[model samples]
Every structure is written in structure tokens, then in C-alpha cells.
Target chain A: MSPVLRAFLIISALLLLAPLLFPSVYYYRIGVLVLINTLSVTGMVVLLGYVGLVSLGHAGFFAIGAYATAVLPAYGIPPILTILVGAIGAALVAAFIGKPILRLKGHYLAIATLGFGMLVWMVLSKEAWLTGGPDGMVVESIDVKAPFELLGIKIKTAIAWYWICAVAVVIGIVLATNLANSPAGRAMRAVHESDVAAASLGIDVARTKLTAFIISAVYASVAGSLLALFNRYVTPDTADFLHSIEIMTMTVLGGASSVYGALIGALILTSLPQMLTVFAEYENMMFGAIMILTMVLMRQGLAPAIAQLFSRGRK
Target chain B: MSEFVQFCFSGLTVGAIYASVALGFTLIYNASGVINFSQGEFVVIGGMTTAVLIASGVPIWLAAPIAIIAAVIAGMTLYKLAIEPARGAPLVTLIIITIGASIFLRGLMQTVFDKQIHRYEGFSGEQSIAIFGAALLPQSIWILGGSLVVFVLLVWFLSRTKAGNAIRATSSDILAAKLAGINTNSTMMLAFALSAATGALAGVLATPVTFTSYDAGVLMALKGFAAMMLGGVGSPAGALIGGILIGLIEAFTAGYISSDYKDAAAFLVIFLVLFFMPGGLFGMVRVERV
Candidate 1:
């Protein structure tokens, strides 16, 4: 089977087997969160992992997706349609903003993204009439009951949400993997290696980078929508600097070079907190230490590092 | 107007602190090519340590230097442990590492100090002096005097001293500087130490007015980073001018517009500057070699 097909199969297997093994609603809830984060990290891998561009403010796009769902339903648009609206909105914003920002290199680009993220955060927190201010707004809960009832299967909310999220993750992974294999993917990699060289080789480096950015924005937006619907609430915290950093950390920690690595990264970071309650106060410190250690010791991240260790042992 | 005078005074006071912090940022960026996100933590460490020391009945004079010394040591430790270990990492990796260091430091501070806000009495008493019909705190005067002295001393150090020339040479081209037999390691250490001292001094000065807490470092870092960008990334003069400009903009915005959007003004200025003039006001346009 092709890698995309193989990835899909593996994701399917995990989603199928995980519920049976754990058999807890709590686990299902956590599974939903992991899948949501996985979807976002999958988007992040396109920019940071593949294109070699860094954004410290993707939480802005995520927040846009979330707020779109929260705010749009009041205007007679159905809640489900808002996901598309959110993704498109995020894409448009990304494209517009990416034009000038993507022109800058390295650390400059990082600062610009940080500014954008802060801008979004300020607006979300200050616009009480629109975003309901810092108290946050309730989103319409997504109901999966009708479809399940039509199929003659009864499932709890958590389990149904888990399935939805798992499906979304699989779709996200498949699309990302396909994109990676396409000619566009080659151009992105070329740009990543050296934009000047890529440009000399007849690649439109600017446009390629922008395209990657928009795609990543759309992914983040979709993840945001799914999270809002699942939680039935949205807050400005969704786009805070810390949340943006967390997403980036997940991307880097999972191995920005591979799709499977991002998935594993999302899973580990999301669940690590739950497992290490005793280390709660040390979370930020540990995140810092982990990031430093990872960069110094295993620059390819946890996934690639483990793979390397396995290959070395086998050899 | 008296209100305008008051705003200007406050703006200058805040700008002075921002200038000191931005100088710290510029120093580290110049020498090591690392942004030192933990620069703000140096300030916090200084202010908090001073507060603790003073509360424990240490003399204000002794406690202040000890706090600054503590911050200097912390800065050196960050460079030694985290930054030096990950030498030659990409800019993104280095950025993440510094950010991680900042988070780690914040966590450490929180664990040790608890999360309560802390401050000590300003160098001078809290008496307000009237200038242009506006009352300015004596601490504000000390802040202004202290920043001016630091800037003058730094300019002298960078221009006249052998070690300063070594730092400049290393910043310009590390390999070439090393070829010239300059100890690049010591220069980098000096840069980190100087940056830390400047940041800590800013923290010590401003804590009386702004107060200090574990979480205060991130916002200070962001503001200082913005100021550094506004003035041009690597220029000392730019850092000072950029910081003051940001302070003025923030003050004017708060005075004329919504106070809630004051923070927004600094970021907006940064965005506009980056878009229109990526070189900033004082920074030369950098050319990347493929």
C-alpha cells in the first residue's frame, strides 16, 4: 500500500483499538483532544516542518476559526457551515498577512507572527460585544445523535466526538501526506532548503510560501472549530501567546519532518500533563528543558530520535 | 497642558526602563545572535531578590547591588547551560531554546518566590517634585539618571575599551574575530553578563513603580523586543530611541484613546515599521548569502 493509504490504515486501527483497550469515557474525551491537537499539528508541519518557516502566532488563526463558529450562528448561518466559513476566513487572512510577513527571514518572521497573534488576542479579549470579552462565549454544541440514530447505533457524546475527531485527523493526515508527495510539496521542500536557490530554479518562492501558510491556517482554523464545538465554549485564551507556543512546541517536539511524528507529538504533550500531575508546577520549566534538550540532543524530535535508536539497535 | 506634561514624564520614565531592557536585548543579539527571551526574567530576578532582601532587613544600598549581581549570575548561567550547549542551532531552534529558558526561569521563580507581587522602596523617597506643573516622583528622577549613566558608560565601554572592541569584532564576524585571536567565548560571556546587568537594573528601578511578579517577564520581554525592533535590531542608539518612542506612543494612546488598547499601539507600530521599513529606523538592511 502507498504511504498515504498505510497512514490512513494505521490511524483507523488506532482509533478502533484504543476505545476497546481503555473502555473509559474519560479516555475518549482525552482522545478527542489529542485528535484535535493532532489535526492542528498536522497543519503546523506544513509550514514549520516542511517549508522551514516559523510562526509564533498560529493561535490567531485557530481563534478565528473558533470565533467564527461562535459568532456566525447568530446571523442565521447554521453551526456546521461555520466550519467552512472559519477555514475560508482564516485562509483569506493568512494570504493577506502572509504577503509582507513571509518576505522577511527567520527571526523577523517570528516577531511579525508574534505581533499578529498579540493583535488577535487583544481584539478577542477587548471586543466584549463581539467575543463576549474575557469571560468567553458559549458555542452551540455539535449534535451527532441524528446520524448515529439513523444508523441504529447509540453512542455517548464523548465517544461520538472521539470518532468525529479521529475521522478529522485521518482526513487531515491523508491530505497532508498527499500534499507532501505532490509537485507543490517538492517546491516547498526546495524553498525550505534555500528560497534563493528555489527561485533561481524557476520556483515562485513567495507564492509557494504563501500557499503553505494559507493551507496551514485552514488546518488550524478547522481544528479550532472542532475544539469549540466539542467544548461548547470559546475564549480569547484560544489565541493567547501561550497556546500558540504550545502548538509550536508540539510541532517541533513531534518531529517537524514527518506527519506521524506530529501526531505522536500532539498525543504525548496533551497526555503528558494528565499523567504527571505531581509535576504540574514544573510544567513550564519542563517544557523549556525538554525543548532545549530536544534541540541539543535530538534535533529531529522524539519520533525521529526513537526511530534512529531503533534502527541503530537493529543494525 | 499639565496633562500632556504628566504623560510625557510618565512616558519618559517608562521609556527609560524599556530602553534599558532593549539595550539588554541588543547586547545579547549582537554578540551571540540569540534574542535572549529570558532577558526580562533577569529584571524580575533582580527586583524580586531585592524585595526579598530588603524585607529580610538588608540595607537598601547593599540589597540593590546584590540583586543586580544575582541577575548577572542568572544571565551567565542561562548562556552557559542552555545557549552555549546548543551553539550553531538554527535561528528558530535558538529562539525556542531561549523561550524555553524563559519559561523554565519563570517556573523556577514561581516555585521559589510564590506568585505574589513584590517591590521595594525606590532609591529615593516617594516625594513628588513639580516640573512644568506636573508632579514627578523622585524615583522617576533616579530612573532617568540611572538609565542615562548606564547608556553613557556602555557607549564608552563599547568605543574605548579593548574588550568592547572584541565584542564589536565578534558581532561583526565571529570567525574573523577568532582568527584575529580574540577570545570570542569571553566576549560572548561579557555580552550576556552586560545584558543581564542592564535588564536587572531596569527591573530594580521600575519595580518600585510597576511592581514585580514571576509572570511579569514575558510582557517586559515582548515590550523590549518590540522596542528593539522599532529602533533597529542591533543598534544601541536604536534600542534607546525605539524604546522611548514606544513609551511615548503608548502614553499618548492611553491619554487620548482607550487605555485598554495601549499595548496594542506598540505592536501596531512594530507591524507598520516591519512592513514599511524592515531595516527599522537605524538598522541597515541585512543581505543573506545563499
Candidate 2:
């Protein structure tokens, strides 16, 4: 009945029908990746789009999640429980550092996050004893097919992961939408408009920013844990600087403002590389060019730009 | 004590090179508000171009100038094509643009020069001289002297020359500079060229000691940025002082602690400094009026 509910239904239907249309395990895997990326970018919506804060270090949280699942299983923790724990770990880390880091504005914040991401990458690569030392370690496989078997429906592992990711995304959207409508979300938007102004209105600017940062970090961690479960392997590359940039690019490219925009950004960026295999070596160049052109052409990004075009067309 | 002196000497050598790059960063940041993340790429281009040219039978003397010229052209082109077009964009957008430009330059270099590390012979022979019971390479002296010369020259230019004054004016206030009939656009272009030349020279000087690669630019940029932040963002003297301190810290860290964590020292120092003194050592404190 409501637009939010209607949008959720449409997205769920699309996710459900995608497997039927593609009917390939490979496509399902890519879809799962898109879903995972979409989950993370949705977090970016709160941080970058809502609060107007940028973090170049989210891959650090993503790494923490993946590594927790990879390493915690050895410590006898169940894989499923580890995912939640990983998210919690990421949230704690974010909250701990967010106070000092959030104090920095603009490029200073960017560089600080850059330093954090690089530190994570270095630790993941250098601490070979724990993290398998750059070569990475295998993750314990998750059992998502148990529910499907209980329902008497036969689904391949890839398709099962795809469905799980889809359900997760739907839940993520509902949460994001709910948050967008809440007082905290309004405070976040107000912070985006002007932190000083928000402060003037009696909002605790520091707490609001930290809240956005921690939420976004938790989202990234969860998405990362899901990715580890889906692939059954985790590498240090999962938390590299470029991957951090890629996440940011997707957020900005898709329009950072809304949930749907996060999904679109993830889908396009995930699919574009596969489609443009010939330009594989020039990937960095393309990324750089896209970021520059996007900012110069339309700062609000693709989804918002397209929405404006449609509105203009109606006029 | 000898070991400590040795570490200090090594620190000063690397510090000098970092100072050169930081100076370039300060120049561009002062003239234009943009922190050109691609500054290190100019260094790589200079080193790689010189290496490839020498390998291709060009005399070393001729190759060096040619390499610098090439980087200058690249710098100017980056300004005109990428930065100039996106004037008045938000700080985040500008940061992304510069980062993108850095990525693009690295990719282009990888394609053109392959992924191999490169270095030419130092200006002098590969002889080590003893100073206070410490061994010093001639290349180290060159790197230190070269950076010092550049610093002195920059100070002179900024204080004495009309073009330098124009750049300073533009940096202080673009509108006021324009009203005073100074060409702000040309000043920006000059800033790009001068910074690029300085970066390229640092690369040329340090390559014999540190080596150069397509991917090295990112780390160098990060280190230079850290150095710049340590001294103060836009102050030339601050850049030199900060770079030396970082280099000394790195050398001491490597000497005393695990060399494996030596690189981490820079980031740790950055965090500590930013936490305690956000404006850096020599940076002016600005009061925000809202």
C-alpha cells in the first residue's frame, strides 16, 4: 500500500525472478556479489549521503568481518554466531575510532580513513600466523540450504546463497527506510545540511556522526561476512585500498541518497567490469575517469540525474 | 652512539627526499586548495622515463632533462584537462578527482613502462664515505644537497620574483589577486609545473637509493602527505621540518623496532599528531566564524 512497501515488493520480486531469467549458477554467484555490494553501499547512503561524511577505510571493517568468520571457526565458535560477533567487533572498532576520526573534516578525514584501511590491509598481509599471511584462508561453508530443504524445494548452493542475499537485502532496505524516517535519521540529514546548524538546533552532532559511522561499519561487516560464507574463502585483497575506493565509487555512482540508488550503483559497478573484460587492464583509469566525470557532470550521481531527467520529461 | 649517528644520517637522507615531495604538496595546496594526490606520479614518470630513455640509448644527461620535461607536460595537461574543468567543485569531489587522476596515471605508467622497478646510477660513483663512524653513500649526499638547493631556490623565488609573488597573491586570495590584475589561472598552471618539476627532481635524486616503480607513487604520496601534515599543510618551512622528523622517526623505528612495522610508524605518528595537534607543528590556527 505504501510506496516503501511497494518498492520492497518490487525488489523482492525482481530478486526472485532473476534466477529464473538467468538460470545459471555463475549468474547466481554474480548476483550474490551484487547483493553483498548493495548491502555495503546501503551503509554508505547513511554515512556519505545522509551525514555527508566520507570514509575511505570501510574495507577495514569488511576485512574484520571476513577474518572473524575465517578465524573464529578455528576457535570453536559456530560460523553463524561469528558473523554477528564480527559485526559487533566492527561496530566497537568504529565507535572507538570514530570519535577522533570524525573530528577531522574533508580531506583530513579521507586521509585518516585511508591510513586505517592501509593499516588493516598491512595487518592482514603481514600477520601471516593469524590471517594466513596475504595468501588468505578458506572460510567454513554456511548451510543456507537447510530451510529450502525443509520447504521441500530443491535449490543449488549458488541459488541458495542468492536467495539468502536477497532476503538480507530486503531486510536491509526495510531497516534503512525505517531509519530514514526516524528522528535520528532526520538528525543525520540535518548534520548533512550543516553540522553547525544541527548543533544550533540542540542536536548532539558528535554522537549523530558516530552513530552513522558505526551503523555503516556494521553494514559493511555483515556484507563482508556474507561474502566469506558465499565464497568459502577470504583473501587480504578483500580489504585492499582499491576495494575501499570501489565501494565509495559505487555509492557515489549510484546516487548516495537512497536505498534504491545504492542497489543500482552496486549492480552497475559489479556488472560493468564483467561486461567490459577487454578494458580489464585499464580498470583503474576507468575508475578514475568515472569518478572525475561523475562529479563534474552530476554531483548527485546517476540515479538522481536520471530521476531529474524523468521529471523534466514529464514537464 | 655511532649506530645512532648512522640512523640519523640515513634519516636525514630520506627526510630530504620526503621534504622535496612535501614542498611540492605545500606549493599546490597553497596556490590551489586542491591536494594533488597524483604528485607522486610526477616522480615516477621522471624516474621511469629516465630509466627507459637510458635503456633506449639516450645519454643519461639528455634523458634526465627529457624526463623532467615529460613530467612537466603531464602535470600541465592534468591541470588543464582535469582540475581546471572542475573548478568550484566540492572538496570531496576534488579529492576524488585527484585520487582518480593518480590511479589513471599509475595505470598509464604501468602500460607504458611495465611493472618493473627502475633506477639509474647516482650522479656520483656508488662509494660510501665515513662520517662520525657511519657509512654514507654519495647518492645520499646528492639527495640531501639537491633538496636543500631546491628549498633555498624556492624561498628566493617566492620572496624576490614577480611570478612567485603572483602565485603567493593567488594563494592568499584568488579574487583579490584577480582584482590586482594578476592572472590566477596562469598562477595555477605555474604551480602545477613547478610542483611537478620539484617532484620529478626528487624522484630522480632518490631513485638511485630508493628505486622507483609504477605503484610506488601511492606510498610516496601518503608519506609526503603525512610529512606535510606533521609540519603544517601550507608552510614550506614546515614541510622541510616535518619531513626530516618523519624520516628520523622511520629510521629510528626501523633501527630499534621491527623493520616489518617501520612503515606503520608513519600512520601511527599521523594519528597521534592529529589527535593532539590538528593544525600541525608550524601551521597557523584558524578560528572558524560561522
Per-residue CA lDDT of model 1 for A1-315, tens digit only, reads: 887888889778887887886657898888889999998899999998889888888999999999999999999889999999999999999998888888887776777777788889989999999999999999987687667878998998888888888889989999998899899999999998888999999999999999999999999999999999999999999998778878888888999988988888898889888778956657777777777777777788888877788899998
Candidate 2 lDDT tens digits, A1-315:
865686688679878887786756888888999999999999988888888888888899898999999999999999999989999999999998888878777677777777888888989999999999879999988789999999999999888888899999998877887788889999999988887899999999999999999999999999999999988999999888888888888888898888878888899889788768855667777777777777777778888877788899999
TM-score of each: 0.96, 0.96
Candidate 2: the clashing residue pairs are: none
TM-score of 1: 0.96
- Tens-digit per-residue lDDT, B1-290, candidate 2: 88999999989998898899999999899899888989889889888999888888998789889989999998898899888888887677788778878878888898888899998888787888998899999999998998999999998888799999998999888999999999899899999999999999898888888899988887788778889999988889999989889899999998999787777777887888778998899997555446
Query: What's the CA error at residue A25 for candidate 1, in Å?
Result: 0.9
Give the lDDT of residue B69 in candidate 2. 93
Tell me the whole-model lDDT of each prediction, alpha carbons only: 0.87, 0.87
Q: Each model's fnat?
A: 0.68, 0.59
CA lDDT, candidate 1, residue B240 = 90
